[model samples]
Target chain A: MSINKDTVKYTAALGRIELSEKEIEHFTGQLDKILDYVHKLKKVDVSKLAPTSHVLEMKNVYRDDKVKPSLPVDEVMKNAPARERNLFKVGKIIE
Target chain B: MELNRLSAHELMGLLDKGDISHVDICNSIIDSIDKKDKSLNAIVNFDKGKVLERANAQKGLPVFIKDNICVKDELTTCSSNILKGFRPPYNATVIEKLLNRNAILMGKTNMDEFAFGSSTETSCYGTTKNPWDLERIPGGSSGGSAACVAADEAIWALGSDTGGSVRQPAGLCGVVGLKPTYGRVSRYGLIAFASSLDQIGTLTKDTEDAAILLKIISGHDPMDSTSVDRPVPDYAKLIKKDIKGLKLGIPKEYFIEGMDKEVKQSVLDAIKKLESLGAACENISLPHTEYAVAVYYLVATAEASSNLARFDGVQYGLRSSQAKGVIDMHKKTRGEGFGDEAKRRIILGAFALSSGYYDAYYLRALKVRTLIKKDFEDAFKKYDAIITPTSPTPAFKIGEKTEDPLTMYLCDIFTISANLAGIPGVSMPCGFTKSNLPVGLQILGKAFDEETILRIAYNYEQGTEWSKRKPGI
Candidate 1:
C-alpha cells in the first residue's frame, strides 16, 4: 500500500508529468496515505460481483455518417499554441 | 426592489410583466458583482457589455456556468493554468440548451483545478471565500457557482458534480445544488473529471429554481451516448406542494462520529419539521457506505487520469516551448500546467491503472462501487427518499484541512455515494449554526426520480427559514 519514489516517478512518467524532487516526496507521502486508505477495499468480498464501469447500460450509439459543418479552420486553430497552415505544430518528432 | 436578490422564478414574473427589462436586471447584477465580488472572490471573470448583450438577446435568468463547462468561444479554463488561454470552439450541449432558452451567461465561475478538491481553496485563481463568513471556504469545485447564488450574484448557475462538487459547495453556501441521475443530464460539453460519476447539476437559491433549471437541461443527447433515452418531465409542475404520507428514510450511518454536533442537530430538527409536515420518516440502512470514499478515489481518479490525459500539450492548451522534443514538451507542459492536487490525482490514477495494480485496485473498486450502488437501490425499494447531512460540518476555515488531503477527501464522504449509485441527489439549506454558518440537508432519490426529491425539498424549503436568510456579504 505504500507509494515509493520509484512508483511516483514511474507513474508521473506514465502521465507525462515531470515532477521535481520536492513534489515526488510530497506526492509519495500523499499517495501512500491515500493508498493506505483505499487499501481497505481489500477487506470487502467482491468475489461474486461484476465490475460497473458505467451506470447506464448502453452500447455503441450510432449516428448518421453524413458530412457535417465543423468549426472553421481559423476557429479550430484559434487556441493552438503552434500551427502551420491547417495543422497543429508540435516539437519535431521526425528528422 | 432589489432585483439582484430575487430568485429566477420571481425575476421571470417581473420580466414577463415588463416591470423589469433584461438590461435592468443585467445592470443590477453587474453592479452587484462590481461591488461584492472583491470580498467574496466568487467570480473569476465578468464583462458588463458581454453580459448585457447576451441578456438583451434572450430574456432569461442571469446564469453562471462553472468554469469547467465550455461556452463556445468563451474562455473555458477548468480554472487551470494549462487551459489558461483556451476557448472551446463549440458550446457544451448544456450551454447550447441554455442559449436556446435565452439563459444569459454572466461569466464562467471559478472552480477547483480540474474539479479535484472538495473546497474552492484548491482553485488556482485563489480561494472563493464563503459569503457568510469571509475567512471560511465556500465549498468547491463548484464553489464559485454556489457562492454566487448565495450572494445573489447570479440568479442560477450550472455546476458539474463528479463527487459532490455541486452539492457540497451549495450546502456550504446556503444555496440549493442538485446532481441529477447519472444519465439524466448530458455531459457532452462538460470537461470530464470522472466520466461515470460526472453529472452537470444546478446551484440555485431554492428547490423550485433547481426544478426549473433541471427540466430545461434534462433529456437525451446524441452527442452524449450515456444520456438516457427517457422523456424529460416538467419538474416544476410535477413537484407536489404537499409531502403528506411521503416516506423519507434517515440513514443512521450518515450521522457518523465526528460530525459537528450543531450540523447533526440541524439535520434532526429538519427531519422533525418534515415529519411535522406529514412526511413519514424512518431509519434506513446503507451498509456499504463506509467504503464509498475509498472506492470513489480509485474509480474517480482512474477515470480522471484517463480523461485528463487529453490535456497533453499538443491539442489546445499550453505547450512548453522550451522543450527540445515532443515528449519533453508534454512532460513540461503538464508538469507546469497542473496544480498540486491535479498532479497528485493523475499520479494516483496512473498508479492504480498501471500494470500489476490494475486488478487489485481499479477492478476491485469497481465491484465495490456496484455494492455501494446496490445499497442505495435496496434502500429506494423501501423508501421514497433518503435524507442526511450534506457535509459533516458547515464551512470550515480556508486552511483547515489543506495540509491533510485525506481529511479534505472525507469532507465528501456523505455525498459520494449518490454519484456512485447513479441516483439523483440535492443539498438545500436546512438550518444555521450558532455561529451563523449554514447547514444543509441532503435528499436522495431513486435513479431518474428527481421529481420526488424536489417535491420533498420544496415542501421543506417552504416551511423553513434557512433558505430565506441571505448572507450580508
Candidate 2:
C-alpha cells in the first residue's frame, strides 16, 4: 500500500506527465505518506455497499439527433496551439 | 459610503433609488481593487476599462467570477500555466445566466491551480494573501473570490467547491460562502475538477447576497445533463423565513483533538446562538466522517486526472515546443505546465486507478463514499441540518503548512464531507479568535435543500455582527 519511486515513475508515465529525479524522490515520500493515511479505508466493512461513482442516480441522457448551429470554426480554433485552416496540427503520429 | 464596501443587496437598493449608478459601483470597486489588490493579490485578471464598460451597459449587480469558470473570450486560466492564454470558446452556464440578468462580469479572481489546493499558494498568478493578516493565506482554491469579497474588492464572487474550495476560503476571509446542492447549479462550462464532487458556490459579503447569487445561478440546464430538472427556489424569499423549532445535529467527530480551542469555542457559541434563536441543537454521529479526506482525494483526483487528460497538447492550452513525438509532447507539456501539488495529485490518481491498485484505493474509496453519504442521510432523517466549524483553525501563515501536503489536506477535514454527501453547506463568520482572525460556522442541509442552510446561515448572520466586520487591510 506504500508508494515507492518505481510506482511514482510508472504512475507519472501512465498520466503522461514527466517527472524529474528530484520530483520522483519527493513524490515517493509524500505519496507513501498519503497512501498510508488513506489505508484507513481498509478498516470499514463496505462489503455489502455499492460503490458510488456518482451521487445522483442519472440515466443516459439522450438528445434528439438534430443539426444545430455550433460555435464558429474560427472561434473553436482560436486557442489551438498549432492549426491549419480548420484542422488542429499536432506532432507526427506514424513513421 | 464606498459603494464597493456595501453588500450587493445594499447596492441594489441604491441602484433602485437612482442614488448610485452601476458605473458608480464599478468605479468604487475599481478604487477598492486599486487600493487593496496590490497587497491582497485577490484578483488575477482585471481591466478597469472593461469593467466600467460592462457596467455602463448592465443595470444588474456586479459579480466577480473565479478564474476557473469560463467566460467566453476572457482569460479563463484556472490560475494555471497550462491554460495560459486559453480563453474558452463559450461561457459557462452560470456566466451566461449572470450576463442574461445584466449582471456585470467584474473580473477573474485567483485560485489554487485547477482548484487543487487548500491554500491559494499553488496559483500561477501567485498566492492571494489573507486580508485579515497578509502573512497568512486566504483559504483557497477559491481564495481570490473570498479575499476580494472580504476586502470589498468584489461585491460578490462565484467559486466552485469540490472539497470546501468555496466555504473554507470564505471562512478564512470572513465572508459568507455557500456551496449549493450538487445538482442545484449548472456545471455546463465550469472547468471540470471532479465531475461528481465539483459544485459552483457563492462568496459574498453577507448571506442575503449568497442567497441572491444562488437564485440567479441555480436551476436545470440542458447543457449539463447532471443538473437536476427541478424548480429553483426563491432563496432570497426563503432566507427571510426563521429557523424556529428547527433541529440541528452537531457531529462529535468534527470537534477532535489538536483543533484550535478558539475555533471550537466559536462553533459551540454559534450552536448556542442558534438554540437561543429557537433552533434545538444536539450531538449526532456521522461515524464515517474520519474517512472523508481519503475518499475525497481518491475520487476527486481520479476525476481530475481523467478530466485534465484533455489538455494533452493536441487542442488548446500550453503545448511544449521541445518534444519529438506526440506522447513526448504531452509528458513534457504537462510536466512543465502543472505545479507541484497538481503533479502530486495527478500521479497519485494515476497510481490509485492503475491496474493493481484500483480495488484497494479508487474502488474502495467509492464504497466508503457510499457510507459517508449514508451518514448524512441518517442524520437528516432526524435533524433539519448539521452544524460544525468550517475549518479546524482560522487562517494560518502563508508558508505554514506548504511543505507538508498532509497537514494542508487536514485543513479541509471539516468541509470535505459535505461534498462527499452532495449536500448543500454554507460557512459564515460566527466569531473571531484571540488574534482577531475570523472563525466560520458551517450549516449542512439535505440534498436539494439549499434554502434550509441559507436560512439558518441568514438567521445566524442576523444574530451576530461578524459579517459586518470587514478586514482593515
Candidate 3:
C-alpha cells in the first residue's frame, strides 16, 4: 500500500512524464501522504453499492452520420509545433 | 460615471435608457482593469483594443472568460507554460451563446494550470492577488475570475468548477459564484480537466447578475453528449420568487473542527437570515461528507491523467526541441511543460489507475461517490436546499498552505461535495471576517435544480448589504 521513489518514477513513466530523481523523491513522499488520507475509504463498506462513474443517466447518444463541415486544414495545423502540408510532424516513431 | 462597478443588469438598464453606450461601459471597465490589474494580476491576457472592438461590433455587456475556455483564435492558455501561444480554432458553446446574445467578449483571466490547484499560486503566469488583501490568496482555480469581478475589472466572468473552483473563489473575493448542475451547461470547447466533474459556471457582482449570466450560458448542445436536452429556465426571473415555506437543510458534517470561527458564525447568521425570510431550516446529515475530498482527488486526477494525455507533442502545444523519439518527445515535453502541482497530480493519478491498484483506488472511490450523491438525494427529498460555508476560512495568506499540498487540498473540503453529487451550488458574500475578507455562504440544490439554490441566494443577497461593499484597491 506504500509507494517508493521507484514506484513514483515507474508511474510517471507510464503516464508519459519523465521526472528527475528529485521529483521522484518529492512525489514519493507527497503521494504517500495523499494515499494515506485516501485509505480512509477502505472503512466504508460499499460491497453492494454500484459505482457511479457519471452523475447523469446517459444513454448512447446517436447522431446522424452526416458529412459535417470540419475545421480548415490550416487552422488545425496552426497550433502544431511542427507540421507538413496537411499532417502534424513529429519525431521518428521507428528506427 | 464609475460604470465599471455596475452589474450587467444595471448596465443593461442604462443602455436601454440611452444613458450609456456599450462602448462607454467597455471603456470604463478597460480603464479600471488598466489601473488595478497591475497590482492584482487578476487578468493574464487583456487587450483594450480588442475589447473596444467587440463593444463596437456587438452591443452587449462585456464578460471576461477564464483562459481554459476557448474563444476562437484568441490565446486560450489555461495559465500554463505548456499552452503558450496555443489558440483554439473555435469558440466554446458558452462563447457562441454569449456572442449570439450580443455580449462583448472581454479578455481572458488567469487560473490554475489546467485548473489543477485550489489556490491560484499554482498558475505558471504568476499568482493573482486577492483584491480584499493583496497579501492573501484568492480562492481558486477560478481566482482570477472572482478577483476581477470583485475589483470591477470585469462585469461578469465565465469560470469552470471542478470541485470548488468557481464558488470558493467567488466567496473569497466577495462576489457571487454559481455552479449549475453538471449537465446544465455544454463543455464542448472547454479544455478538459476532469471530464465528469467539470462544469462551467459564473462569477459576477451579485446573485442577480449570476442568474442573468447563467441564463445566457445554460443549455444543452449537440456537441456535448452529457449535456441534457432540457429547457433552460429564465433564472433571472425565477430567482425573484419568494423562499416562503421553503425547507432548508443544515448539514452538521460541514461545520467541522479546525474551521475558522468567523466563517462558521457567518454561515450560521446566514441560516438565521434565511429563517427570518420565511424559509424553514433544520439540521441534516450528509454522512459521506468526510470522504468527499478523498473520493474527489481519486476520481478527478484519474480523469485528468487521461484528459491531459492529449497534450503530447504531436498535434498542439509546446514540443521539446531535444526529444529523440516520439515517446521521448511526449515525456520530455510534459516533463518540461507542466508545473509541479500538475506533475504531482498526474503521477498520483497514474498510480491509482495502474493495473492491480485500480479496484482499490479508482473503483472504490466511485462507489463512495455514489454514497455521497445519495446523501444529497436523500436530503433534497425532504428539504428544498442544503446550506453550508463555501470555504472553511476566509482567504489565507499567499504562502501559508503552499508548502503543504494536503492542507491546500483540504481547503475545498466544504465545496467539493457539490461537484461529487453533480448538483448546483452558489457562494455569495454573507459577511466579512474581522480583517474585512469576505465569507461565503453556500447553498446546494438537487441535480438539475439550479433554480432553488439560485433563488435562495438571490433572496438572501437582496436582504443583505455584504454584496454592496467593494475592495478598496
Candidate 4:
C-alpha cells in the first residue's frame, strides 16, 4: 500500500513517538518502500493455513503461589525520573 | 604466544595447569583491549580495577559480553541511546550462570541499536570496525562480540541472534558464532528484539570454544518460560565424535545467481572439503526459502514494537523534560531516545499490526513462517544438517547499505530462516575472499540438535586454516 506523511504521523502516534516534520518526510519515503517490499508475502496462498504465532508450543505456564523476594525499593527506584515516598512519581494520569 | 590470542578453553586449561594465573590472563586481555580497542571500538565500557578484582578468583575467566544481555550493575544498553547510563539492578539468568562459573565479567561490547541492524553502524556508540581491515563494516548486531573475539580483546563473548546477528558476524570476523536452538539458552536477561526468534549465543575464537561456552550456559531456567525443560547434553563430548557419513543439505536457493561470486565460491569450496572429510552432501530444496526475510521483518518488527514499549520513559531510561502530560512524556521520550533505525522499525511494526492491516501483513507472515519451518522438517527427513553462506557476501564497507532500508534487511537473508524454524545454526570461517575478507560456511541442524551442527563446524575448522589466521589489525 502507498504510504504518505499522514501514515508516518499515525504510526508515530500508535508507537508513542513524536517526530519532527523532517523525520515525517524522511519516514514517509522509507516506510512506503519497506511496506511495498513486505507486501511480497501477499502472493503466497495461505487460504488453508493456520498462523503460527510462535515457533514452539506455548501453554499457560503455572507456578505455585509463593512469595518470591522482589528487588529492593532502593535499587528499583535507582533509575526513576520522578519518585516520592517509596513510589514512582509521574505526570498525572487523570485529567 | 599471545595470551589474549588463546581460546576460552585454552585459557581454562592453562588455569587448571597452574601455568598462568587468572590475573595474568586478565591483564593480557585488558592490555590487548587497551592497545587495540581505541581503533576497533569493540568494547564500549570497562573498568580495569573491577574486572581485575573479579579475575583474581581461581576459576575467574574474563568474558566480554554483548551489551544487550544484563550483567548486574552494568549498563545493558542494547547499544541504544534510550538506555544510556542505565545499569540493570539484577543479572540475567545467563549472567548469574556465568558468575557462578567464576566467569570474569570484563565489560560490555557494542551492538546495533536495539539489535536492529546488520552492520554495527547503527550503534549509538559508533560502528565497531572489522579487525581484519579497519575500513570494512563488521556484520552485526553482534559486531562488537565477534570483533572483540577476533582481535583477542576478550577470551570470548555472548551475542544474541535473532536474524543472523551471531552467525553473520562470526563469519565476517573469522570467529566461531553459534545461534543455538530457540529454547536451548534462556532469554531471561536478553533484552528482546523478537522474542520467539531471539537466542543468546556464543562468539569465540573456534568451534570448540563455542561448544564449551554453550555447555556452561545452556540449561532450563524457571525464570524464562520459553526455556526448554529437556536435559542439557555434554556438548563438549558430543562434538568429539566423527562426522563421517552425516548427511548435509545444500539448499539450491541459497546460492542464488548474482550473489557475490567470491562468497559463493568460498561456501562451494567448503562443501568440497566436507566431502573430502567423508561427510555426505546432497542437493536439497526449501521451497519457501525466499519468503523468510519478508516473514522475519513482519514477525520481528511486530515483536520489537511490543517489546520496546517498556522503554516509554515511565520507570527507567531517558525521560523528556519537555513532556507536559503522561502521554506526551512517552511520545517525546521515545522520539528522542531511539535511533533512526529503531524509529523506522517501530513505525513499520506499528503499521503492520495496525487494525486494518494486521491480517494482510502480520497474520500472513506468520503462516509463511510455518511454511518456512516445514521446509526444514521435510529436508531433515533425509538430511542430517543444512549448509549455506552465512551472509550473501563478506563485510561490505561501512555505510554501504545504510541509505536503503530494504538493502540493509537483505544482509540477513540466509540466516533468518533458521531463526524462523527454531533450529540451531553456526557460521565458521570457511575461507577468505581474494580481497581478504572472511567468509562463513553456515551449518544448520534440527531443533535442539546443536551437537550435529557443532560437530560439522569442528570437523571443518580442524581441517582448515581459515579460522587459524589472526586478523593483522
For candidate 4, what is the TM-score?
0.99
* C-alpha lDDT score of every prediction, in listed order: 0.91, 0.92, 0.92, 0.91
**CA displacement after TM-score superposition, residue B435 of candidate 2 (Å):** 0.8
Please write out the lDDT profile of model 3 over residues A40-85, one tens digit for every residue.
9999998999999999998799999999999998988999999888
**Chain A TM-score, structure 3:** 0.94
Supply the TM-score for candidate 1: 0.99
Per-residue lDDT for B135-224 in model 2, tens only?
A: 999999999999999998889999999999999999998999999989999999999999999999999999899989999998999899
Q: How much is the lDDT of residue B305 in candidate 3?
A: 93
Report residue B209 deviation for candidate 1 (angstroms). Answer: 0.7
Best candidate per DockQ, number?
A: 3
Q: Write the per-residue lDDT of candidate 3 for residues B1-473, one digit (tens) a residue.
A: 89999998998899899999999998899899889999899999887778877788888888899999999999999998889899998999999999999988888999989998877999988999999999998989999999999999989999999999999999999999999999999999999999999999999998888888888998889999999999988888999999999999999999999899999999999999999999999998999999999999999999999999999988888999989989999999999999999999998888889998999999999999999999999999999999999999899999898767888999999999999999999999999999999999999998888888989998998898999999999
DockQ for each candidate?
0.86, 0.87, 0.91, 0.81
True contacts kept of each: 0.87, 0.84, 0.91, 0.77
Q: Rank the candidates by DockQ, best first.
A: 3, 2, 1, 4
TM-scores, each model vs. reference: 0.99, 0.99, 0.99, 0.99
Clashing pairs in 1: none
Docking class of 4: high
Restricted to chain B, the TM-score per model reads 0.99, 0.99, 0.99, 0.99
| Residue B211 C-alpha lDDT in model 4 | 91
Instruction: After superposing candidate 3 on the true structure, give the runs of residues whose Cα lies further than 4 Å from its correct spot.
Output: none
lDDT winner, 1 or 4: 1
